[model samples]
Target: MRPAAGKTATLFKDTPLALDGGAMLSPVTVGYETYGTLNGARSNAILICHALTGDQYVASDHPITGKPGWWERIVGPGKLIDTDRYFVICSNVLGSCLGTTGPWEENPATGKPWGTDFPVITIRDMVRVQAALLDHLNVESLMAVIGGSMGGMQVLEWIATYPDRLHAAVMLATAARHTAQNIAFHEVGRQAIMADPNWQDGRYYDTGARPEKGLAVARMTAHITYLSEDALTAKFGRNLQGREAVSFGFDADFQVESYLRHQGSTFVDRFDANSYLYVTRALDYLDIAGRHGGRLSDAFKGASHVRCCVISFTSDWLYPTIENKRIVHALNAAGVPVSFAEIEAAHGHDSFLLDVPEMDHMLKGFIAAAARTRGLTGGTGA
Candidate 1:
């Protein structure tokens, strides 16, 4: 039951993972990574849920892409998440292809990849598996749960599903539910993958012919939604790619087009098309209010004691500040301890991961206050 800190770890469960769509997945396997150390009280643990396309390599280099961990900016030693002071645990969420049980993983019963046949999972289901992982590690409660974007949805699910398991929660650039625009964007991505003839109906695994073009196209479409119009204009305007005049060809003549193409091409190398479909579907299906009988406050009924912090970026239209305010309002109605902040940033939804000193200061202050209440020291732990 000891945590396999630093390296990848797995937990096997004989029971089944109940899905919202009324299906059961047995022999569940959860892949995770841990940072820092667990103190004697074991109450210093912090759970970080990753956003879409993010993996377990939170504070370390990704083994596949060889890129620095996505959140390395704020989770390392002496940083906001301070690995030296908090036992940080991050897992490749269920329905994700990165070392977790997902469409890309083998189905225990069929001996083949689940692919499109995988049961439709929800954010709550993802949180359930994480809870099981904590149970295996004997972590009865967490100091805090933090996430942004899709990761933020998971944080809300965690608070709702395991109300008393965490003392504080930080949700950044997220919403309580997906909007029509969100669903439309995801549908476009799904269509892109399905339209690719090489997909072979989600059986492209091990096949020499993969739907790389479709997957890349899908990534390109989704990547645009991750940034703001202001950021896009600032980074890549209508400026031509190379020559002074327009080429008048379909070839990426614009700088923005070239940038998006690069984003798509690189994405196909590391992501599975089927996994993307499943995860986006999960995102679209996330609705805390729907799960709680059309009452968002009902979702937080049992979490009244848990402190909540909601963060929204000024330019994040994907999950705008209005959406975050909905959560805060619900928490207020539910009588839960809550705080809200709207930070001004030009990067849009991706601002949470960028260099935002304000976010860092806010996170540090929140965690420090929470640590003091938990009787934990401020400096690095032994």
Candidate 2:
């Protein structure tokens, strides 16, 4: 069960997908990467799910950005994830741009980009595809499943859909469902994309025009949510970018504006506009409770074998501590062993992506405990 020396393919030819909406998806593919060695018992497997705008390059360099993998700080040989002791596997979620099937992929039927034709997916569907990929990899069970943000949604879905398949779970900075406000913000981004004339009804490929402006605006809007008011104020509040005074024109007169603009511009180069629409739509549609008769506890009722750790940040208004508490409460009622932590941090939803010493300590301890309970060795400290 060890990973090969070089990159390998996990997708099969013309895979069939049974959609929740009763539609059929032919020729499905998933992009993924594996690191470390699975022991003879195959009991050391860990799955890492990525958030929105994240790819499968968990410990390697990003092919497009030419930067270190997004989670390299927390993963690798001796990092928090400890690839030396755990066989870690990460996959680009279904409906993503990085080598997974999405709007950017060509539609076999029309021989054009799927674009608007791409079927709307749910978190459950994404997990389903991941489960299939795991099957392809010959992994019968997982030691743990860990993720944050949209990745966290996948983590929750993993536990619900395959309760007995994983020994433990780690969910960070996420929610069981999208709130009305969350949907509203995602709609704003979708509107921005559609408003761009270059979008061309989502058939922009033939036109050779990219909705860079609109997509950048969308990225700017979402990036704001990834930070806290305090962070924004501390980083750039009323400050001008290389200018002593604010410009009277509508151009970026403030440092914050300039920073956001840069973020948006850089994002478009590596991301596809239509993929943003599809992935955000999946996030908006995520609701494990709604699918389980409006009770969050019911979703985990059968997941008694799972030991879970739920982490939240103090300043994360988007999927705040209260939301995570609700999840913990549900796990408690379901009689699942769980640990809940609301760490003190000023970084908001992005804290999980940053190097928070407290979070690192908590995760190291929790993961070690979970591994010990599952009869694995080589435990690390808090």
Candidate 3:
């Protein structure tokens, strides 16, 4: 039952989706992409959740940027989450601007973009939407759910909300809840966007204007958090930007500054400022433990039968190994079969997206091991 390659599933059309903020959202559209076949038993499905800025293009070309999908290296015909033997699914999550219901989308009530009016969404809400997407596709269960960073938050939510819907989960560089530093960084980004006069309280869509400067600054700031000091040193260091000496001006004097400015400029081209605010706020509000009486273990009460593999990088202070350990501890308290790995890498929080041989090998081995247990074929992953 391999569905069409690109499809968007509509849900909450008749029944409004109950949000954590007590507001109901109707006519939620989920944009998604599928690869390979669902297999005879419908037991070969693998859901790949994307990070904050990612969309539905997992193993294909991005429509907006015309660049290869973010995870093309790890997800393809022979990649780690190989599309050859597994049916792969990836969706643009709610509160995201990429072909999904988000702040930039129109609100039926006011006939304008939701903007700041969009109800605050949480990780659980995002997971619920994905579950609905699967239901609409008639997929009862998934062989494995995989993600990293914010995507990993959704993976953890899946374990809490629909334990029986998936057999295994691979969580990388994430935590069960948002740390103070996480919220702080997100708040800074939000402040930067809101400070721009062009933002106009997120109502610039009609005026044909955008908060490009603010959004670019926000992206520049957040991009720093995604990397490590060691990686930064190795990549750029104190190298001057196309000059032998200092500029003695505000221009990019160092190569790192130039690179960051380039990153900021390019990011604003494909992302919406309002959507950035909503998504970051959603991530900051992710507190599975607080939702379950402040006990992280309580969130996994019904996930005893689920298998989990948690991985973290040594240089990833944004979502450090300590955070992953806390999750492993909670899963252990819940008697869930879980494996944890701490890879030594200098790429920081973004290590999972880079070409780290150890991560590639680990994912290939872990996916293969899970596939074997589920009676699925296995082959070498890229």
Best by lDDT: 3
Q: How high a TM-score does candidate 3 get?
A: 0.97
On the 0 to 100 scale, the lDDT of residue 286 in model 1 is 92
Per-residue lDDT, model 2, residue 360, is 89
Reference-based TM-score of each model:
0.96, 0.96, 0.97
Question: Residue by residue across 206-308, what tens digits does model 1's lDDT show?
Answer: 6778888999999999999999999999998898888798887899889999999999999887778888888899999999999789899999989988888
Specify the poorest-scoring 10-residue window by lDDT in model 1: 1-10
After TM-score superposition, the amount by which residue 197's alpha carbon in candidate 1 deviates from its true location, in angstroms, is 0.9
Name model 3 segments beyond 4 Å from true.
Answer: 1-6, 378-382
Encode model 2's per-residue lDDT on 191-226: one tens digit a residue: 999999999888886677989899999999999999
How much does each candidate deviate from the true structure in C-alpha RMSD?
3.1, 3.2, 3.0
The clash number for model 1 is 0
lDDT (C-alpha) at residue 380 in model 2: 67
Which portions of model 1 miss their true places by more than 4 Å?
1-12, 380-382
**Maximum-TM-score candidate:** 3
